[model samples]
Target: MNRTPESLTAALDAAMATLDEAVAGGKARLTPEEIGHITYIGKGIALIDGLPGVRSEELLMLGDGVQGLVFNIDPEQVGVILLGDYGALGAGDLVRRSGEVLAVPVGEDLLGRVVDPLGRPRDSRGEPVCHERLPVERPAAEVMDRAPVTVPLATGIKVIDALIPIGRGQRELILGDRQTGKSAIAIDTIVNQRGKDVVCIYCAIGQRSSSIARVIEQLQRHGALDYTLVVVAEGDDPPGLQYIAPYAATSMGEFFMEQGRDVLVVYDDLTQHARAYRELSLLLRRPPGREAFPGDIFYLHSRLLERSTHLRPERGGGSLTALPIIETEAQNLSAYIPTNLISITDGQIYLSPQLFQKGLLPPVEVGKSVSRVGGKTQLPAYRAVASDLKLSYAQFEELEIFSRFGTRLDDETRRTLERGRKVRGILKQPQLSPLSPAEQVMVLYAVTQGLFDAVPEPELSQAEAAVVAALGILPDIVRTIEQGETLKPEALEALLAAARKAVSPLLGPEKVADDH
Candidate 1:
């Protein structure tokens, strides 16, 4: 032992091996689990053989930490849907079973972050340090464990809140043609959630990156990003990602809902989600049904949307409201997907191109849009002002349509048309400018009281602005409506007096008195 470099290295190696054997009790030989080799790969899918124990929906490791999900299993082989780059995969590649289902990181830290379906940060920020992981597929709360959807989720859109009030835990479908302000409604709803104690998750499936960027910018500009999480599976991503994006977003929102917090999740558009599912299913060789879609297409959405619910008090009393958007071709509601979602959701808000083209903005077709749960969840103040609005508007529309055909109109009909025009004006809200409860009440009360009847159509906007300003003079009216949830007769009288005072200068005293 002359202590040469070679001799010292040999001695050190021997000593280290002896220490490891001693620490391991001579049982240091570790046996690896069974591994499968890919036999075929294409179309974001692969077939693996040699792993007999792989289960459906189980995670598979395909080298370099890349993973896939076991989509189909057979005695001979298992079909896997690649969640990462498939171009790098080749035949004979070893894929190991992870023995776990796919999950996403979830926690409070996920708020204000942009991520993918796998919980990886997409905002160019590093990975989020989340303490908990949740499975993307979880059964919804049971009936007994769920509570009634009585609490209102104010969207701050006058038309929606006044006529189609969405309740907590409700699944309201926002269906319309492309570029018809469907996403606008969802974004505005998220923007309105600021300071409302509601967490928001916006999932973009198969949308353009530019579009997603614009949405992010809008939320940031409005300070809504603080309470929102954005999950994006853009148009260029694999279909598997688009398929899983909504479910992953739902899981993230579920974390908050379980903590007794209210949440709102928007599937920017499920039409693309459905298409992604169809692509995946067809690639997996599944039998096709209507429109070449998989037979389980309905099940795909039902399972995901069912997760949105309100838990009973014993189960934390939290709620998850779902606003799933669907795009139709040429405003055809008879399409298969639209009809499926319509049947699955509590009710739908139908956006009409005809109305949209007329510069009606949101273009929520009153006759076509119905919220089965919203009316019941409306605040008392709103209910009182809006109870007769829909009917009156419907009558006005009918008369207006007839009047358009050169039909004769009586004095009563003319009065009704004037009232309806004011109603429509009051409901036409600007983008990103959601109305407060007080403003809604003031505007609606004015329309109901015929205060704006004398104010011509061209001056409705200005008159409304003046009334809203005057409403500020009486903070008690707004506070009482918010707190007591109802407007007393005395409160209405005072509101009327205030409105007269507010509009006297704007509308001229003679017109104000004549209208009064």
Candidate 2:
């Protein structure tokens, strides 16, 4: 027999297989493990000197079960950002690769539970019952896989729904100075999602414990906890945890979105998220740019926000709507981070500190805020009621500013100012009390139709409440409006009649008859 190389190689393989089988019953197989040692330790990061094959963003285990992320891979040393307590870790500590990237538990079980960025239960409840895990970083859906945003995500805030509307799958930025009701809008939006079949995830990054508790309590009190998930990375958490919090929350929401469910993920102020990243990047020796932020700062948010979109019917027909909040300083929208976010989002809802001081609960500056896609998604009834509303409101604002100089005005301008005041009054809603679409339309219709012009400005809230209460009697009209249909002439008349009857006592017969 001619001993060919192929036959010889096959014989050698067979001998090795027989030897392995012979020892399988009595001996265990040994596998190679790559271990590195921390060469230096910083506040929330460590430098490792081994693990030549370690991948960037891969999870690493350090002393005492502390986890770290491979933030930078260098020829001589690797930079790892510690995700947990680093006090127990020091130089020369052993580090082991997890052989996987950073991931968090995701499933239906996570809903209604308060958890940290790592998906560990933070509530009194036991461990989360999730059966699957997903990586914290995911590529966004391709354009071909996304559908046009056609459905409205009604926030139930009259000003938002009437002027600065939000559409499902749209990335709408909520930006304002501190204490300007930025988070309030997001929370109210979540509260409004109740019974709308929309799953909400609120990611609190670098917020105070008391603030987080307050938010959770609000959700519970409103029964929104049943459909909402809270992901918290408190202000004192490690910078690494804060940096990854929103991404982890987004992954959790993506799980539900893939299941054909509409999901809303609110990043409560990414300013801290950016600051956390800046800290980590500076520690990792990455070069900083304007505002001392890493050059990839814009890319960081663009990538995360790009993941939110409406998937095609074939892909799931689900949508992931993002309401990422950003905090500004001294009402400066031109700041570095604010500008980046404003350019990235489909539109922005600018909350004015000035308006907030004036006791506007939402403080949404309509002139500065806009909705690029929501107009197409708004209901036909809303279109009819607010077609000229925004323009008229803008005009009133400019005129009011001029009138502040004590200039004498004509009857027409005075009437416009009065109507505008009524409009503003009707838009002022109390916190935690979100209106339904039907109720919003009713009150908005009354204001836009000049029915509220005669009503006393001091009694606007009471009159608006009366109109909302009267909606119960016009169930057919309510149903029609909620169904997104164009309001019929008779339905409009019926709504007008109900509004007059509801506010007659407050307005008096003469005031109510003035409308005719």
Candidate 3:
């Protein structure tokens, strides 16, 4: 029952069939000269996303490496989407490997600035004036026959030290909900690593501009700007760009890592990065999963983060530590993405907004957060103090919960409760101040040893923070304690004496500010 069209329709129909076959399956080998110069326009190489579309019937080179191909139709003229290595091409790019895939470069310039997936400067600073760029997803550092994580990675915070301490080449995930200081924890870690011979990369994906800016400012304030590299893929970036952001940052981190140097990369939050992929998938007509995210979402994140690792002993003894943050909606740790991260990391620092509001800056839930890798790399001093740290914390939690029942206990029970209360106070600090590792150990030991029992139950919080502040512990303290060294009992006692002496005056009745 099909009606025949006029003479012109016959020729058009014949051409369309040829176009379809060539676009979908025909072999089209571009000459070496046609690589990097291809036009980024969709007409040249149509990308319809998930759905297959019209085929390219013919190809011609514009001589400057620019490839002009005839497609049955253009797919909305969207800009080119890089699928893979850009380094193989140069300014006079050719199309020999037509889809070699444009990628961002990794190098020394990445420290302390925000960048996009394409490795272009997303901070509006123009293309990074860099010495070089590298492809984003490279291989993992050598596996077995590898050196252990001997050095520590300090975050300048007390709780992280006394518990959940990080080590070089560790893959630690920072999991939390919004406004719980996830990024803050990451930045603090980077800033504190300033002089530790570690190169830092901060990759920001789908974050607000203001928030990204604040990250840079924090680095600058801590004098970590020069040594830190920033890679940003903000919320305004195109879907394609956002999808590639973390890989670009990884590439930058790998540069330092390969040279036998320590490298730390923080993918500020992978949730948005995954969202960007889902958007791209929908646009390309790919199937959606439960969250409308691509089915390979887990693989995508794993591959990016897996690139960070400790190398084999024969591989220059290099390492890449990753701190990939995940923001769970409504603290839904059971969600696919959250669970995926919780499993991938060696450990997690579970930040809670509820605790932060109650004056826990890092707000780490010591019970929920743990390093599965054990204290393999903690400084000896840190190890010693941390052994009893958790026990003390558990006691504090149990006693506090029991006190809530209002069943008055014996005098000894009340004293134990008061001591536990003081320990919690010592760990609390203002919004940004991070402690020295020494201070962390001292506070941990003091609280666990029942040294703070006399500080008064109500003033525990402020009194706890003062012990370190007055002694000027931190920055230098954690390092000395963790340097694979030892200390005599006398020396240890001397240090504690100094911290106690510093806290005594501030623990008086008129020292409300010290306790607060």
Candidate 4:
């Protein structure tokens, strides 16, 4: 029954008197809807004594506009929370529906604003124009189709770009220390997608208000917020909101992907998100495990991150690229949370704070990261560069380190060191710094060719140009090769032959050899 002001007022007076009596006399009984109604006032919810349909004594939350989240809703007797204390809640709040759902805005006006889980603008910009609304409540996962990831998502991080590349529908985890640039990398990737036909959803759960604000400002400055959706659940929000923030963002991303638009969904950090679930679990009397987290922590991450996938071609042919960030304490990645995430993702871009301080923006440790699904999305030119880049770096690194102590190094090792240095220099961009696709391909070629070796003194522009000029010639060479495969050695050789003649004067007479 819909409530008018007078009727709701009468009902409230009666309920308030009853609740006061219960608080004073120590006894009260009510039905689930009544309990749902009462929980908006503040006692944490749970399955109470012998309640027929009580799901759990979880907290109930209702924002000003939408339907509230009530866990155990019983239609009988209106189960009531007598002394409920909804912090900052007014007595005038009415229960809408007993559903834990929210709406998604579909209009273009939201292009530049940062929003929270409730879809409220956090950017201080203005209200977002709504086009469509969606229910936050999800049905069971049985009917959903499972699909593999095959589309490329250019994060523009070197180690990740070369070794641990992510496909359109891939779930790529970024695990690292507090100051290791995890969130920055995710944000940069989102910003980089501005001109591309991609939508970005950034979910910030249990993050500091200041940090969240900074992210919003960063997105706004870069104009990435225009094409991105920001879903924030701050550190002070109820645990329930933290648990649902990512889901709300993912739903928004899925909506676009279904319409044949690509979506990049970044879970700013899931470590706190998982902890929030564990907090609620413990509060509800669930048993804890090795890390004092609920046993289902792994499953929660798996299910959430797995939601990013290239839907089967028959299903609109769009994709959701997932980049889930995990914060590891003291850089101990062996912790239960990091391990659980590592197992669930296709690959991880492990950022080291030590490297970040050493001036590496992405700080991605190539040796520590590996993409298991490499064959799925790597283009021929990219794959060719990646395949040999690692070996060269390793060979160069060993020689360079020893040579620092005055040891003589082999020519091959010296060349590798120069290449490695150029690679490192190129990767050292600022946090949340995004590079263009053309820029990525250009530098990629610089590494492939030993351009670093011939530079008596490497100028940034020179290195950048050498790379762009190399990549400018790839389309003509790989025109006949199939997508998702590396360019053939013979094809590459022909390109390199012309490249040598073209660059001999500009880069000088350095021997460029073909890998046989």
Candidate 5:
């Protein structure tokens, strides 16, 4: 089967001809790139004097892999937002146009890790092994591609689940002053997604390292870190990094959401984000608006939050829920940043400093806190039990305020006041402790059935705990609620009777009495 020498030479000649043609084709194509120069550099921003073809939002590269985004295009120079170490860059340093937008790495390997705005690992681990890169900014899903938010996003906090529920893709703002347990709600929500198929992203912009460490410890303790990603731009980081942290984190979460998985992203507090933007804007010489913030401050937040939504089934039926936190000074909700966020978000959970000082754990100001979309997404079981709960609580609060004026209350008024006290007590939950839907339903049923009537306010927590334990052991009521069954009058009466029978013994005869 040996081939002739002349035939072999012919085949070799054909292979060489193909190779020469490919090289000629490669040489015919154009490979063009523009280079710029740093005219001036300071404060995490650089002025580029060339790259006339550079477009706004385009990325530029410097020596040693440093990157910058074209922020402000000017006649003489383009203001570039530095995304890396700008201290090493100086005037006349060569800068080449990347011809791409700033992007971050996103992948499953990022879970259970802490990273910077650039998607680099901050957990002291080696570099993250991500294969996909997404731009920091992306357009929101079109209206036709989005679905109505009809699914519940459980936070596991009794008060929130019962009253201010959050939907799967809604943007619910957590607004309050410092030490109002804002981050606690976010962390508890993450912990609640333990078995639920929800991916969580926590963006800590301009936060202390100690605070971030504590949050990581909490997640690891509860095993939530297995499905959660933490993006940090510490207080010591450049304002530019802080400004882009939430957006970068959003891109990471968006990656999962596009894969038809639900995602929950918490911007730990946007106050710091706004401040960072303000600093960067001023450094870039943008005009200041109210409170010295840039005029585009509203756009800054709306664009980020708008990225969170429920995709239609045609678009994979996934969702991204945003819990954006904003800090206010002296409880001023009308502040520029708070107001802007409140308008952009679906609703807000306003934590009251007054209630905090009074020893309420979450201190959620029910009067001010509202969930516009959650009402539609609330479980039918919860809706049946808590339909009148908020109204009754409001009435009780008004009556209590009036009673504080030294007026004697009638039996009905006094009864309302006592029930409200018990309700408040039941809602007081410890940080990091999350309740399941069934546990929440059982406790609310007990309250509605007057099971806590005899328990003193000081012992209400003990009563609720007993009720929770009884439900776990009895299993019937929890099973019904977990199955999403409707709790009718007759059915609730039976469940309450069984619950009372099981819980009263745990509360002891001294604390149990006939309310009728």
Candidate 6:
């Protein structure tokens, strides 16, 4: 066992040969990972030094599995928006680059499920079965890849569908003061998509849990949850989550849109989303502009909304329609954020607090609400019946205002005011009750033709309900209307006949005598 110089040399040479063989075989390769340390931590954000190779919006892992996004990358350090509970993280904690941008799970499994911005299930439904993951921030479809929005997206609300129509692939703004039925309109639209083969995604950013629960309950009650996806970012969630919520939800919708399916995404209100981004930007020391918002606030929403468009046939011919809700301060439409959104979207559906106060449900202000592109997408039947409806209603509004001064002296003006009241009554709809296209056409035809003018104002609702209920006997006429055909003379006669019969019993003797 005594070692000699020659024997030691022989053993050392053999060990060197083995090491070279392992290296040449690629079995001993070295893997270098970049790790950094948090230099400072702020509310929902952290400044990290080192890891100079991190990319903007890249996902990073902090201490104890907390995730962060690289927001501001400078020579000295990078600002990260924390995505999880950062309470466990402190300055000097370890940070590792995930080397990937933030992505969310997207697939059929998301239907009927409630998830967070990170695609984590919050509905206690266990892990979602997602077969694919898409980056939260994706470039929109090219201009050539988009198609004109010719198909109508019916909200089943008589007023919206007949007057302020929404088309597939349109970006429609729903804005109003608080407690003015803005959310009600959006939910009704979602519920209306129950049998329409449209996939709906309701992204609630910075909303109360109870409010979100009520929405879910309504969707479930109407069986809309079957094809709907609820993506929630509660008010208590980190600002980062709220900021990325709509993008993640849009990514989820894009999956279906690319599959030749129509998708509807509702950003319950972008006010909070903008606020969340503002908070993050200020904390990260980004330059602020008007209203203390970052300069890119316009781009922030534009890019998100631009993702919704109708695709060309070669690109699967699908579409993503957006209903972005915004709350106004004291009904101010010219405010900074409201004006920006008004300029971005295709049209605005301005709800009126005055109308709401008057017990007009949905409370959509006809004068302020408009659909820029939806006019081209309305049904032929609507054009035949409601073409002059909007103009007449606007005139009625003007005349009614003047009449309030007790200055009305003309017979025609009095009749116009009376008709306007009846028109408003017909447009008033209950929550969760969406009308069929044929039914909407039926009721619209009745009012536009002055059939409801004979019924007393209080009896208008019953008369309209009776007209809708009596539609079953006019199956052929309903079919014709729903086929998007113009209402022929015979069809109009049939509609009027059925409507008159249904409304006659409800009319009082005084109303009947006045009509005669």
lDDT of each: 0.89, 0.93, 0.68, 0.67, 0.89, 0.93
Compared with the true structure, what per-residue lDDT tens digits does model 4 show for residues 235-331?
8776767877887787777778777778888897898888877776666556899789988888888778767777655677788888899898888
lDDT of 3 by residue, 252-345 (tens): 7777887788888898789888887776667545679977877788888878777877776577778889999989888788999988788777
- Per-residue alpha-carbon lDDT of candidate 6 for residues 224-267, written as tens digits (9 for 90 to 100): 99999999999999999999999999999999999999999999
Candidate 2 weakest ten by summed lDDT: 507-516
Tell me how far the alpha carbon of residue 348 in candidate 4 is from the true structure, in angstroms, after superposition: 0.4
**Candidate 4 TM-score versus the reference:** 0.76
Point out where model 5 deviates above 4 Å.
1-32, 473-476, 506-516
What does candidate 2's lDDT look like per residue over 1-516, in tens digits? Answer: 699999999999999999988888768679999999999999888999999999989999998799999999999999999888888788888999889999999999998999999999899999999889999999999999999999999998999999988999999999988998989999999999999999999999999999999999999999999999999999999999999999999999999999899999999979999999999999989999999999999999999999999999999999999999999998888989999999999999999988999997788888999999888899999887788899999999999999999999999999999999999988999998998888988899888888888888888998898999999898888889888889988998899889878878887767756756
Model 3 spans > 4 angstroms off: 1-99, 112-114, 123-131, 456-466, 469-482, 507-516
TM-score of 1: 0.94
lDDT-best of 3 and 5: 5
Clashes of 4: 22
Candidate 5 achieves a global lDDT of: 0.89
Clashing residue pairs in candidate 1 are: 165-374
